[model samples]
Structure formats: C-alpha cells, structure tokens
Target: MERLAKGRHHLANRTSLLRMISAWESGARDASDPYRLLLCEAYGKSPDELGLGGGTEHVRSDIGLAYLGSLESATSALGELARFDEMKHSAVILGKYMPDALNAACLDWLFGESLADLRLSGSKVTSQDVAEVRTMTENLDRLDRFLGGEQCRLMALRYLRERVVPALKASKTQAVGRDLFSATAILCELVGWMAYDTSRHSRSGTSPRP
Candidate 1:
C-alpha cells in the first residue's frame, strides 16, 4: 500500500493513503477520476476488472467528460454517444470527469494494450480497409475545420457506429489491429471534441453548424 501510494498513486502522505485505501475498500468515498486512473494503471486492470465500478461516479455523457480509463470502456462510452446521436438527442448534455474509467484507459495505453497483436480467424482486414478509414477520417477532419465541430459530429458518430466498431469486433492481424486502433482513437477524439463544442454552443445559445 505504501509503495502504491508513493510510486504508483503519487500520494503525498501516509495517512492520506491509508485513509483513501480504507475509503475505497469500505465504499465511503467513490474513487474520483485521478485516483481511479492510478489504481487501474498500477494494477494492470480495467475499472470493471478491478471491481471498482461501484466505487466511482459515472459520467452520464461524454460531452464534458475529460478522462477515460481503457479502450474497451472508452469504446463502450462512445457507443452510448452514438446511440444518442442516432436518436437525435440534444447535444447540450453536460458531463464531469470520470477518473476510474479514464485512468484504466490511460494505463492500458501506457502498457501497450492498444498496440497488442490481434488474433482473428475470419476474413483478413486489408491495408485497403485501413486506407479507407484514414481517408474518411481526414475528410471528416476537413469538414469539421471548415463548417464547425458540430457539423461533423453526426457523421463521425455514424462512421464509428456503422464501420469502426464492427471492424474492431472482427478479427485481424497485428498490423491491421494497430491501424484500426489508431483510426478508432482518431475518431474518438473527433467525436469527443465535437460533442464538447456542441455543448458550448448550446450553453451560449448559439446555433450549431448546418
């Protein structure tokens, strides 16, 4: 625990470390975004894998949510956002940082989980597939830059839900896996930025990009 506090958790004091541990174990304090991240990284586990879900506050939406833990969890959160976009929900949704979720994801990336070889037994994901995704993302980036972030949100969400997520679920080689993960990361960043923009626009009573 001491080592975790000083080295992994970066806690400043022994008393605070013991108190935090006790709180986390006893469920007295929900793990905030930062601490959750430290715990996840130190342990090489997901928020759910470490039985830490109930101990943290969940961001109801990703618009304002700044942190995420693992690719899997971040993907799941993106799925939720896609559903909302599909339903034509309001873009003014607000969110807070979800430490545990973001922490796990950060640790996963730091440990090269995102770069791991993918094992698959189905049709190969070709270089062409990767190129297509890259092109599409570039186009979306251009669109967002010219029109506005809001202009690209729906298109980004659709691409993610219809194309990216499906490809990720399928099997592919290490090369393809790296490309796909990279593409997904780009898409996620685009969507998150767009969402944040939309929220800002809504708050200021300004119109979104047409």
Candidate 2:
C-alpha cells in the first residue's frame, strides 16, 4: 500500500514503481510498449544468459526466483496498470515476453515460475502446449476482431515456432515439446489482446471508426 501510495503521489515514483514492478517480469528496456518486440528479444538468449531451465537443480539456484515471487505480488497490486483491457493484458502482465524485442533482463514471476514448477513437477505444460482454457474462452471474438483470425493465428504460431521453439530445442529433456505447447498456452491473455486490437472497439487511434 505504501509503495503504491508513493507511486500514486509522485510522478518519478510512479515511473520508478512501474519500472521496478515490471523489471521482475521484464527488464529496463522492456516494461515499456510495442510489447511483442520485447518478447522476441528475450528469446534469443541461451540459458547461460538467462541462467534458467534444465532441472530442479537449476530452479533452486535461480536468483530470479525470489524476484519472480515478488512479481506476483506486484502484478496483483499493479493489476490496473497491467490491464489495457481484458484482451490487452499484455501491457500490464507477463504478456510482455512474446512477439516482441524480448531481450530484456526480466522474468514474469508467476508465469515463469509456474511453468518452471510444472517442468520440475513433471507436468506437460510446455511453451507450445495447447490450452483447453482458450478453447472454452468466450471473449475470443474481440481478439479475432482486433488482430484478425489470420493475423492472430500467425501471431500465435510465430509466438511458438519462432521464439520459444529454439530454446526448447536446445533443452536436453522432453520438456521441450511441453514448453513449446505451454509457451503457446501463455498466449491466452495476449489472445485477449486480439479481442481488443483486432476488434472494432480497438480502432480508437489506430483505425478510427467510419
């Protein structure tokens, strides 16, 4: 509350708050905009650069683990800031990692850790895994309207095959398949961005209404 209060009260603090919170999930350059670009950048690094993945041993040694945990708390506190809308949660949440520059030095605590835990637990939640939740999602039309079905499909596909695939490919375990699929699963929120960016309502400044 006090931290958020400081952010609310002071402009510099607000910016600082934004930077600090997002840093856990993204890095300094990220935590900004044009999101997918950031995600793409983050994809290029080897585990040596990120120093994550492999096995339970890696998870234990990860320095970002604590930061990732704090990020979950910060995300909840900054929920409003993270949410551009239901579909555009990319601006506010871990959605910053995909389809973008992606080279930032951050991890979206909960999303990253949960995926890690699933890997450690031997669950099949890979980056490429298909999510049943999205299949049953009711708000997809807005996403389709924003990015369009073709673009959205392409966006989702590129998210998997281009970015996360290489990382998974380098993995020594079968978790690569799961990571490919799970990485795709992480797109649900961004898919919501599809509802916003691809829809008529999203035409605010980009494509005005006729």
| Pairs that clash in candidate 1 | 33-99, 37-103, 68-101, 68-102, 69-101, 69-102, 69-104, 69-105, 70-105
lDDT digits (tens) for residues 13-84 of candidate 2:
556756654663553222222222233355675332442211212222212112333323322222222122
Model 2 ranges off by over 4 Å:
1-71, 74-78, 81-101, 106-132, 137-185, 192-210
TM-score, cand. 2 vs. native: 0.22
| Candidate 1 weakest ten by summed lDDT | 201-210
lDDT of 1 by residue, 1-210 (tens): 345556544554768868877887885534544566667888999765776665123435443243343445555555545544443434433333344545554464566434223334456677787788888888888898889855577787678777776676567777887787787777667666666676743322211110
**Candidate 1 overall lDDT versus native:** 0.58
Deviating ranges (above 4 Å) for candidate 1? 1-77, 88-94, 97-123, 200-210
Backbone atom clashes (below 3 Å) for every candidate: 9, 47
